[model samples]
Target: MATRPPSLPTQMKAQFLDAFNTSYALRSVLLPTLTSAHDILIKVDAASYCHTDAVLGAGKMPPNPPSFPHVGCHEFAGTVVSIPPNFSSPSSFKVGDRVGVPGRAFHPCGACFECSSPEGPDADPPGYSVYCPHSKNNGISTDGGFREYAVVDSRQVAPIPEGMSAVDTAVLMCAGVTIYAALKRCGLIPGQRVGIMGCGGGLGHLGVQFAVAMGFKVTGVDNADAPLKLARSVARGATIVDAREQEASEVAVQVGQEDGKKDRGDMGLDAVIILPESQRAFDYGVGLLRNHGKCIVVSFPEQGFHLSSRDLVFRDISVMGSLVGSNKTLREMLEFATKHNVRASVRTLPLSKLNELVVEYHKGEGGKLVIDMALPDEQS
Candidate 1:
């Protein structure tokens, strides 16, 4: 049986992007209604600003650019306020349940090859529906959680763990899950050495914590002092490298020394996850990997990766790109985070401060910035 929904307002305040590279306009818009049977209305409690938001705003997301006047922000946490009467599937959520939505993909076309079940006994697992091309991307191509209320696909929502605030959950929805998935893609076992490039930024900070919690020996690489301090605070005994002062090769040697490797030739990390959008940072991360080591790219740079043939063929280094996690991975990550007490270090501000937050984001501020949607809008 579905739980009863509380009384909701017919109109609410929301922020919309009128054009590329323009500030978001706050306006009173009709509260979003359930357009699909699987849709659920949420009273947004918290939403976080992400680097992807900036990319989307800059019109850099090509192939399918976002329609103007689109609601921005893809990472959010809120309470379920309503569910469509004909909601599909066995509803795991009830009205008033705290939930967080992964904003990358929504309402995947179930008939596609990526969504179909494996055919043969040894068939590879079906790809994550989050990668389905037919799916809608919240904040990028569709409305997202930058308002007092939001309409989300029921299939994409995850239950917020007990004792976790909506602000923290909002951060986890994107930055947390993306970094965790990247680490998992590294395929390194416990006690293996892993390096996190840009370890003090939003995704980087969480990456450092998750890697340490997963029992890997972590080395945090960053160019700035603020993020380096953040990385050191969260990484415990892990090595912290300042890329501004040391070259990539020098950083690699430092990591090797810290790993207690006496043979200089054998010194290198098992894997390195690139979390910053800087091409230099990406190159530096690749340089830290040992022969046969994997380099995971999570950040998108305008110029793309500049890898030499030597880094690929001679070093036998493998490069992998990771997207935001699937629903299964999100659930597992939340569980692991809850069990290990891993949380994002966040600074909360009201929705009215979003524009300022975006500016701060471009200036390379450290830690996650989340909007407390429950706070009274100053403009209101």
Candidate 2:
């Protein structure tokens, strides 16, 4: 077991929003108190921002999100400082263990079909504790990991494996597990071909890496040089396409040509994962699939997809919505990441610079911005 700090703070700084479309503010708030028998208080070490944070902060999360005094960031990693006694926890973690709290941060109702299914303990049923009829998103619906210390449900966190840092694991929390779930839903096997739209962004990049690691021939699609370059670096032997230079339909034609089967318009990708929120990306992704191929819908667009009914019926394309991922898949992805040495290309900034970082993030800056909570005195 790791040693606990000699002292714990009563008050901690947190970045939060007072209302929708408001700026994030850093304020000294009382440290969260424990409530549930399985609740654990953690000293946050790292956290990362996501596009969903922007949507949630705008009061846009569907099915009615709660009013403000909302915290930012859903993906975080920290050290366990306190745990409830007699909890009979599922996780084997104790105080001082490094762990991560991801987006699916609530215990699902065990009575649901998804929970009782034979898919094992990690499968997420339709009525997941968070999202849809249940709106239990961590940062969106509750105070998240923008503070120095946070109170988290024990079931919502998992122990960090050996040879992985908190920041590296933090990248996997939301984006990694999400892509892994998307791939799992598609059911692609080795030698299969997959196209990842927005392959340069956080999720897209990780998607390419995971797909390649799983032995899929990957094609990364994105227009930006920053993401495209990063995608190329991560997805060796994977094809990179520019959306600006060609349409989705055009890319489909090109992919068919790869097999010298341009004469056969029926040839297309085995599966395509849409990672960008752009409808065009979704449309392009649909064009890349072969007959009966799966199109995994993983991105969240403000405006929903405008899919073609004719193509859906005739082309025999199937669409699957992959939310975060089952705990089982998460563990698998983390193990894969650890084995393959896959890591999110990240740019670290002090948590104090969160307000500024949010602005820069909107400017389309490079790399994922991780809030490094190491104080000045704590830094080397």
Candidate 1 local lDDT, 235-346, one digit each (tens): 8778788988878778777778877888655678999998887788888898888788999998878778788888789888899998888777887888888888888788
Off by over 4 Å in 2: 1-6, 107-109, 112-135, 260-263, 375-380
Best by lDDT: 1
Clashing pairs in 1: none
- Compared with the true structure, what per-residue lDDT tens digits does model 2 show for residues 224-252? 88888888888767888988888777777
The TM-scores, one per candidate, come to 0.93, 0.91
lDDT of each: 0.83, 0.78
Worst 10 residues of 1 by lDDT: 119-128
Q: Using TM-score as the measure, which candidate wins?
A: 1
